[model samples]
Target chain A: MSEKNKSDMLRAPFKLEYDYERSTGPIIGKFFEGLSNQQILGTKNGDNVYVPAAEFDPITYEHLSEFVELPETGTVKSFTWIDQPRKHHLINKPFAFALIQIDGATSSILHMITNCNESDIEVGSRVKVSWSEEKTETIKDISHFELINE
Target chain B: MSEEKKDHFISPISLDYNYTAGAATTRFLKKVSEGKIVGQKCPKCTAVYVPPRGSCPRCGVATEEEVELVDKGSVESFTIVHIPIPGNPIVPPYVCAMIRLEGANISFLHLIQEIDLKDIRIGMRVEAVWKDKSEWDTTLENIKWFKPSGGDDIDPSEYRFKGPE
Candidate 1:
């Protein structure tokens, strides 16, 4: 084929973009605000407490309004070791994405666990939230969970 | 309860796509780049389709015959866009029309220009205005826009397809 034909058959670059601005409503909005101040907050639905503050009762389906301040330290319920990290991952090095059940909260919150090896961590391992030096009103405000000395 | 303003956040998203134009579309686009209009004719219904799909939508049979279509055709329907939108190829107050090419069974949507927006009417004759030969490519963008072909308007009844009652 000719050079002109080759050029004609070349694929064109196309990009799709969407810029969206939205409100987080009353429930999740307060959760992000607490993260900005380096505090962990949850919502209590009767006997059960949700760490990643749910907007509604998981069981009753009623709107949840009761807020509970949760301790930063928790135990790792389950974790998976990432031997190799991808570019989009929060941490560049190997880390574990774990479900940590914070103190006084019944439901566990999923987060990254770092500053330890694969062999050093397991289920029921003690961990604490590590606050970022620069806090933003986002989940990234808590850098990652670290292994507790105890 | 004290009335407090709800907090809002902005999130920006971007995605890229690499599409492969298959066999039938590749043939149609190649002819378009060569300053020609080609359509695939359905064997069962004799319907000719521009930007030819490999198979007939109604008959569900393969369209194998290539039919050359005229650049001039009639505008079956049109609407003048009055509201401005982001990333629009053309400004507001322009006309977008569904044009049925002569000798083709289907009508396709394209921008109509070089005529008064209000003057654009049903069955108005129009023709494709192609870009420079050097700028031509295997894409519909090669045809810059459809403009009034300067002829008497055809009767809408003649172009309208009568479906089974």
Candidate 2:
């Protein structure tokens, strides 16, 4: 048993490619359809209405269907710096990923932060939706999240 | 049961992927239809790759030459797929293995046959049993399975490779 032969037995390399198709259920369907119409929809959970219509009530885990519209401008509740990105992420470069709570909405949506440096970003920062010139049914149609000056 | 008893509905969704072929794998699959085993040799490292490969991981260079390998090989590792993956073409309870064939430096993954799950030994020798000539295709299914290579259980250390039974 030579060391060279042992190494070969241990780690044999192979490559595999797989194709995956995900079914967007009714909840996500309505949200994407709303985005296509240039209108944002939210779900009403008791007294609070949330944007990007929540799939289920966070507390009760109930299917939420009540819909409402909210202003595009929002406040950043929490944020993180994504230095190294993975495939299908919103942005490729080092950018801040933020949780934005739009006005008239209780819950928030996760999106990327843009046009601001690491020094400028804070948890309580104000942000606005910079919609894309080419609108699509996908979430990226919102373009990039812009930092709104206080 | 009245006139309004028509309460049945069904829906079905099917998807197909136009899979692209890689360099060495394309050649390997082509040979399988002709009932042959093929391998690729690394130009820099000199290690032979079964089921072929585009590049040598060690040398980081494209494998240039095509080489024919022995249909017989020793199992390196194997798993029984008891559960069926949805939309998989093959039936369940099939054995998939990484076999270290003679003359090839690396192993290739394929199915093994003519042996039971309990009788399978890690160091047991096995030979490729090809499918009927009429049933050959550009797929790994051409080699039905590796059966006992006509030898009794030998010392694991004496054998060059110890594949999963």
Candidate 3:
């Protein structure tokens, strides 16, 4: 019956974490394998090249097999800037989640752009892949992107 | 590139969150820091909830009256944990119990200490073994664990969930 109702509440930062073994199957696995060697790959749908190889054609719904290697450089088509990142985010500093279209590829892939200010980036900003020092054969192999100073 | 193609990937996911203990439970924790245990008494069914969460589940009524309880209880049920918990100082094969405190209708979970794993049985008497008074804070964790109190074993059925008969 103290005046100060000071008791510890369960309001604290908590981290729920787990590691799961996931099967990449065939098509997606090949793309990850290419990332391990610092290569970017896409699947061809007629005249268009789709980055992050699609397993089946969107229009025809047929299995597409042709793989095309593309450049790591890309242009940010759409993005949302994170002024303040949370603890779970891979990049602790300010960054942007971007939909980037790789040069010569008709489709875009989702990735992060870091090490820049808000004024340094805009829609259609030229960026290049910033590879992680360690390779895990996953999308994280391409850790993030940086604005190309061209 | 080398020959092998990858088949499997280990995906590690980490989620951050905030957990808040609402009103009634907050009052209970404050009592615990002062070296007392308390619960909220339901207005409708009159069932006492330890570490009270404000509302009664059976009657769906607010439990406003606070009922203070002694730091003693009986083990309604218990499990001896064999697997080691990450970042826990306790060794394997410790006893975790569902303790039904005296004056409370419901049971709450806490660790049991100062006894062998085999000797632990249902209906056994136990008392809260709290941390030093200086270390006490507004948390259920004020009670470090529970220990045997050398009292006669109460009937297990006494602490069983009370429902409409």
**Ranked candidates, highest lDDT first:** 3, 1, 2
lDDT of 3 by residue, B1-165 (tens): 235767888887778777676667777777887998888888877888997988999899888998998899899999999998666898988999999999789899999999988889999999999899999987888899999998799897787667534
lDDT of 1 by residue, A12-65 (tens): 577788778777778888888898888899999878999889999888899999
- Compose the digit string of candidate 2's lDDT tens values, residues B52-90: 767888778988788988787677677888898865777
**Residue-level error in angstroms, candidate 2, position B104:** 18
By TM-score, the best candidate is: 1
Best DockQ among the predictions, by candidate number? 3
Interface RMSD of each: 2.7, 12.1, 2.1
TM-score of 1: 0.78
Residues A9-32 of candidate 3: C-alpha lDDT, one tens digit per residue:
435567787778898867788899
- Candidate 1 — what's its lDDT? 0.86
The fraction of correct interface contacts reproduced by each prediction comes to 0.69, 0.00, 0.91
Listed per candidate, the RMSD to the true structure in angstroms reads 4.5, 11.5, 4.9
Per-candidate local distance difference test: 0.86, 0.73, 0.87
Chain A in model 2: its TM-score? 0.79
Off by over 4 Å in 2: A1-18, A84-88, A133-136, B1-109, B112-126, B129-165
Candidate 2 DockQ vs. native: 0.03
